[model samples]
Target: MEKLCPRFEKAMGLISTRWVGLILFDLLKGTKRFSEMEADLPISGRLLSDRLKMLEKEGIVKRNIYSEFPVRIEYSLSDKGNELEPVIKAIQFWADEHIPPEETDDTDEQRV
Candidate 1:
């Protein structure tokens, strides 16, 4: 096997975390409010918040706060995050081809 560069290892480490890929994939659809994302994904509010913060720190996600009656916050992919479109699609394609669908009746699987 070839040696892995530190930069590549760092990036892979960031993106490979649980829920990160799914989060990015959802954001690709368009900007989403915090509640909306929470509804769409089965992730806990705390975990989601932490992941969003991490992504923001990495410059992969942008969080926008709107001064409204209730204070609306939305999340969208940054340019760097958008660049992962091909990578996300490739993973989706590979999973579709190689992974068999689960026969579980749990509705959680439908979320992300």
Candidate 2:
């Protein structure tokens, strides 16, 4: 048997994490603040923060901070992260074809 490519394995490891893929998928819409994502995703605040930090470190997500009375922060995909749109869309297409409606949370469908 042949071993998997390290790059591919690492990518899968990162994206396959719980809520990571969903986070990316959500970002496909556009830039969003932490509060926005927290409201949109079912993931906990701590986990979302952790994943955002990880993605930023990996250069897949970009974080912007605003200087103001109260600082504002927003998250957007980096060039590399935007490159994942196709893959995420493909997965969504596949899931739509194969997964039964009952298997997925109906609320998510409404949200999208």
Residue runs of model 1 more than 4 Å from their true location after superposition: 103-112
User: Candidate 1's residue-wise lDDT over 47-89, tens digit each?
Assistant: 9999999999999999999999889889999999999999999
Clash list (residue pairs), candidate 1: none
Model 2 segments beyond 4 Å from truth? 105-112
Q: 29-50 in candidate 2: lDDT tens per residue?
A: 9999999999888878999999
- Which candidate number would show the highest TM-score if scored against the true structure? 2
- Choose the strongest candidate by lDDT: 2
Candidate 2: which pairs clash? Answer: none
Candidate 1 lDDT (Cα, whole model)?
0.89
